[model samples]
Target: MQIIVVGIGGVGGYFGGRLALTDHRVEFVARGTHGKAIRENGLEVKSIDGDFRAFPYKVHETLDTIDAPDLVLVCTKSWQLEEVAQQLAGRIKSNTLVLPLQNGVESVEKLTGHLDPGQVLGGLCKVISKIDGPGIIDHFAFHPQVIFGEVNGERTERAIALEGVFRSAGIDVILSDDIQLAVWRKFLFICMISGMGAITRQEIGVMRADEHIRALMETSGKEILELAKHKGVGLTEKDLENAFRAIDAQKYHSTASVQRDLMAGRPSELHDFNGYVVREAEKYGVEVPVNAFIYYCLRPMEAKSRAHE
Candidate 1:
């Protein structure tokens, strides 16, 4: 398969690095020092799965100068999704598939706004990773996996073929029957935890262990659930419990990249996660005290961080 990985951050770097290990044509789109490092020394991955180097890999600074690819992995942060999708609009073959592995529920909705709806897949990835240095990726925790499917729940040939491609790289993958629901499930978990992490400025274990902090997380999660309900997304009590289960299973020091970015005075997916709920809640006439508080509290930091960029 001719694959184009648009971002070489933790999510893309690990998955794209794995694909690079295959016979498949895996090209990368990276920038600045990181792009130069990969171009000069190849991409290095330090993983619990075992360290490996994928050299002789193609790295592009932009999507220009490339022919149509079989698949385009939209690996940019949630806040960059729209701009990336716009760049991809009408640039790929009609049959090409675009999958978003970001931690959000509106990936497909956002992508379809710019590209052919049929060409976009509802997707999400489960992995704990980050860039350790220029041209280097660190897979620190979690058994990585990609789950995706047609937005309408069909077992399409393309979705199956993509799963096979991931498996060929020894990457765990799933083809969901209801991908929209799957994305919402993941969002439900990510937004709650990430919001709490930012609000408390604490790690997962610390927040989970503190009674008041844990309750705050639950309250914020319920707000998200209410907003999802109004948006026609089915989120049940069982799903909330399942989200907490995953949170509990995390290593104590765990923190989402969004939190890490904010802590380091870098721009993050603040609007895409908690702020998204606040806006939608107003649209749906639902109250979201917890999520609103989190979003407003972090807005100044997020703005100041972006100003530096």
Candidate 2:
């Protein structure tokens, strides 16, 4: 299948590069310096799995420059979802599938509302990757997974074919029948980490070590889980426990990129991740005190970051 990867940031660059390396018909949609770099030197991925490069890969700056694709991976940050969706409409065919591989749960809703619901496939990516520099994607984890499903939960030809494409490239593909739950589980894990890390200006090592911070993290997770349950999400008590334990077992010593962006005075995705959770928690009358505090504390930092941006 012909694929177009939008927003060639960490997620788009790495996965698209892998598909291209394996001789898949993958085209990258990028802009400015990143686009120039990929065109001049190809896309480079540095990962524990292996380091390799794909040369002469198709790269374009706009939809007009390319043909309609079988799959369009919308990997932009949540804040850019609407704008990207508008541009995507110009290129996507009636049957073109959109897989949103961002950090939040709202992408699917936003994209599907703008485009055809059937054309938008629910997707979630679990990986720690970044664009270290122009044309270079650095992946810190060994496991890179991508999951997607039909909106109606029916197994379709494109859904299965997309899975085959990724698997042929050796990706950890989870073709979920219940993708919404997977997206929520990922949001629950990420929001807590980003919220706590941003407010405290600490990495996972220091944050998890402090009892007060650790408690806050756990509480925030519980608050979100409760909200999910209220919305009739099928998450078990064991699922909640396992989510917490997975973080503990990782022995992580890290902070989210949003925290780093806040500190560096660059616009962060806190509004979409942490801020979104806080807003949702309030509607449910679920008091997420810890998360609420984190949102308020980071307000000034986000303001400062936006001024510079």
Candidate 3:
């Protein structure tokens, strides 16, 4: 299959590198130093499961250089989704399957707003990874896996075929029956810890160990649950329980990409994570005081980062 991976950052670099290891024709879209490094030295993944390198068949900064792809993985930060979607609209064919592996629940909506809805799929991934260098990705923790399915939850032929492709590359993948719920389940955990982690400038273990911080985290999670329920996402109490369990299972020093970005003064997913929840809560008449507070407190820093960018 002709595959295109947009934004070859942590998630993209690792997953796209895995796919590139296969015989499939995988193309990468990246920019600046990272793009140049990948083009020259190949993409490298330092994974706990095992280290591997994938020299993509092609690499480009824009979609114009490539042919229409059968699959496109949107791995940019949540805020960049719209821009990437606009770029993909002209490059993808009718049968292209676009899977967004970013955080938050609005990726599918963002893509469909710009591209054909039929080409979009609900997707999320589980992995603690980041770019260790220009062309190197460090997969430090977790069993890396991709979960994806049609937005409406049908097991289509394309979904099945894609699953086979991932498995053939020796990557773990799940073909979710309820991808929306799966996305929300991941969102609930990420939103609960990420904003607070940024605010506290601490890791998951530190936040979970403190009683006051733990209380704040619980309240933040409840707010997300309320918002998800308002949106009719079918996130249940069991899901909420499982979210906390996932948080507890994380490595002591584990910090979300959003938290790390904020600490490093880089543009972050604050608007996509806490800000999205606050906006949606206001629209649905739900109260999210904790989320609102975190988002407001971090707005100044976020603005400063973006201003410099």
Clashes of each: 0, 1, 0
Report lDDT per candidate: 0.90, 0.82, 0.92
TM-score of 3: 0.98
Q: Give TM-scores for every candidate, taking all chains together and pairing residue i with residue i.
A: 0.98, 0.95, 0.98
lDDT of 1 by residue, 1-309 (tens): 899999999999999999999999989999999989999999999998899998635899888845788999989998888888888876799998999999977788888889999899999999999999999999999989999999889998878889999999999999999888888999899998886798788999999999999998899888888888988888988999999999999999999888999999999999999988998899989999989899999999999999999
Q: Which candidate is the best by lDDT?
A: 3
> Any idea how many clashes model 1 has?
0
Kindly indicate the candidate among 1 and 2 with the higher TM-score. Answer: 1
List runs of model 1 lying over 4 Å from the truth.
Answer: none
RMSD in angstroms between candidate 1 and the native structure over all alpha carbons = 1.0
**Residue-by-residue lDDT tens digits, candidate 3, 1-309:** 989999898899999999999999999998889999999999989999989889999999787787889999989999999998887778879999999999889999999999999999999999889999999999999999999999898999989999999998888999999999999899999999999999999999999999999998889888888888889988877887898899999999999998999899999999999999999999999999999999999999999999999
The lDDT, on a scale of 0 to 1, for candidate 1 is 0.90
Q: Clash pairs of candidate 2?
A: 204-254
Q: Model 3: which residue pairs collide? A: none
Off by over 4 Å in 3: none
Worst 10 residues of 3 by lDDT: 61-70
